[model samples]
Target: MTARGYPKSYALRRGVILRAAVHTTMLASEPALGGFLAWDGTDYVLNNADGTYAAITFDGSDIVGVFFDAESSYNPYVSGGAYDIEIFFRGMPPRLRSLAERHALAYNRQNYQCRSMALITAAFWSVDDYLTAAFPWEDVFRHGAHIVRVELLGDTDEAWQEWREAYQCSPGQLAAARALFWRDLSK
Candidate 1:
């Protein structure tokens, strides 16, 4: 059973795990669900699982946010080095915006910056195409931020090199290439 208390769905694709962030009031209201875990004030993890759980935090009224960590021991597949991925958003919804605000506050308070930065190059082909894309750059980047830094927790040097070559971006050229890619995709 997944942490949401539902049987793990075969339909659910697994790659990177995600979690929710909630406010104290919400935690107080739903002790059974929220009490099972503790809030580090930055991110939440499963208390009982062998480091394999992801959670989201919510405000008293609604789900406010979600995030992930690099050091989670549950999935060893996450690389020690940076993994190149892109998150694009069509637009930020109210719920997502609230979550983002909380995530930023927590990240700043913890001083949890990515030691290594990962490059994401995304383009929107079609709405459906964007939805079908493995990593939804359109949806993830909807805040209008030109660039974002991501941490890679599950990739290897060889794999990173291969991806870089395929994308044709050196570390220096990554930002420009990503911008161009996104621009071309928008059309």
Candidate 2:
């Protein structure tokens, strides 16, 4: 099979910085923000950004992975800026998104403890693991990352219970999943 994503010729220059097309427009236009970034062979320099940078692993020109510190705020929501702070791998092979969505659906359907929108969302985000391994560096070049938070809380208890039964989700499982979701968000 042919390798996908960024070609084998892209190189990370130490002092080079590129303007990131941040999906959040509010965070992209601030001049005093942390958009200015530089690669230090380990992590990115925030360059006045409000948050920390995640460690990016590159194999020659291909991005093998991104390592976020457990305690560091590497996500754009926590970080006030967007440029160089957020990286989305859209060119991570065809059907990667669909595959991840399928995986999430299957996982929730099979695991009672993971039957929640939160876990599904997490699964979608975690799809980057597969993308990094299979496609590499494509997140940086291609753009198609869109995240929508849909809170489908039924209007009534009976409705909610019916929906849960239809989806085969247990109340305890949903509670645990919600806890996990909050934990990740609070982190």
Q: Which candidate's lDDT is highest?
A: 1
Each candidate's number of clashing pairs is 29, 2
C-alpha TM-score for every candidate: 0.26, 0.22
lDDT of 2 by residue, 1-187 (tens): 1224422212222111211111012133344334443344532322223222223333333332332221233332344443231133344443544443333222222222333331111111223222233223333222111111001121234433443453344565445434543443454
In model 2, which runs have C-alpha deviations exceeding 4 angstroms?
A: 9-31, 35-41, 45-54, 58-63, 67-132, 135-187
**lDDT of each candidate versus the true structure:** 0.30, 0.29
Query: TM-score of predicted model 1?
Result: 0.26
Strongest candidate by TM-score: 1
Error of 1 at 116 (Å): 8.8
Query: Candidate 1's residue-wise lDDT over 34-102, tens digit each?
Result: 644455653432322322223333332232222333333211234444333223223445454556445
Query: What local lDDT score does residue 161 receive in model 1, on the 0 to 100 scale?
Result: 48
Q: Total backbone clashes of model 2? A: 2
